[model samples]
Target: MSLIELHTRSLELAAELIDTVQPEQLVLPTPCADWSLRRLMEHVVGQHRGFAAAARGAGPDRALWRDAPVGADPGGAFRGSAAELTAAFTAAAGTPGRSRLWLPEIRDGGPFPLDLAVGFHLLDTLVHAWDVAAALGPSSAAGIAAAVEAEPPLAGALLAVAEVVPAAPADRGPGRAFAPGRAPATAAGSFGRALALLGRDPDWAPPAR
Candidate 1:
């Protein structure tokens, strides 16, 4: 599918996941170490908002988008933020799509194309959504399949990043394994495995399972 479709799908999955967050789970710890479930939701929503601002040709400072504790229930906050993000993204994608962005990840004080920005958003939401699901427990994996399908660049980027960066000690976390310094290899198996290779695990299976 095209990047827009993929992004839309990711957003849809995000909406579904967000609606399920219970108040108690917000403070739960996740695979991301320091980020609690509430913090993770904040990160996810805030990032989407940042991306939306970017889609509108808004250049945002990193601090402006930093994660914070969720005041309301995470699910409700997520729904509001996701809607805002979707609107902004839609507005940006509606025109000729020639906006430039300042994404540090791509190392461009970018004047990047709109499609590229949306693709980046898709990749990010996919993993972070799964991160939240992991904290919530087992009923979360269904969204991973949709998220994995949304971003082709994630898989490709992982392979390329691995080829360039030397692998670290094997026990390092999944995220570290695909960092720029490691020359790792592409993983085998499903899209989930591919995501794992890139340092995002779709299987974030329950700790007990």
Candidate 2:
């Protein structure tokens, strides 16, 4: 799948999971430590906005990347942000030149190549989609399936970017984004391996209430 296709599918899966979230589930714990479902949604919305801004050549504008507020209607808010992001990416799909993405989190604030930037976001969306599905507990078969479908494309996208994207320093440790984790013996599928590569325990599940 093309980067745009992968990104579009990622957003679709994310939106599906977001639509499943109930008000009571907002406080549920996710695989991402210390991030509640609501908090995770905030991060997702913020990233979409930031990426959208970057696609529009406003990569350096920090203000456009601000964390989106999760109001009472979290799903509605997410849908809006996702729509904006998808539109931006779709609009930029055929444009010339590499898209500049401002990534302040990295050591050198990067205006990274467009494909690389989209691939990075695609990776995050896949993993975070799993986080949400896992948080939804054992009943989330559809969500799990969506995540599984996302794996192969995600792997392909990451592999393509790996050659151009510099490897993180060894000393960066396990907590860094994209750090590999110990894959559980039971982690058999592509999604599981992808999760392990992203420093997530594929076997992780929310504690039973």
List lDDT for all candidates, in order.
Answer: 0.61, 0.70
Q: Give candidate 2's TM-score.
A: 0.82
> Where is model 2 more than 4 Å wrong at Cα?
145-147, 150-155, 158-175, 178-180, 184-187, 207-209
* Residue pairs that clash (backbone atoms under 3 angstroms), model 1: 100-111, 101-110, 165-181, 165-182, 165-183, 166-181, 166-182, 166-183, 167-183
**TM-score, cand. 1:** 0.71
Q: Evaluated with TM-score, which candidate comes out highest? A: 2
Candidate that scores best on lDDT = 2
**Model 1: ten consecutive residues of lowest lDDT:** 176-185
Cα lDDT of model 1 by residue, 111-149, tens digit: 667766776676676656767777777567555554454
Question: Model 2 Cα displacement at 24 (Å)?
Answer: 1.4
Position 178, candidate 1: lDDT? 36
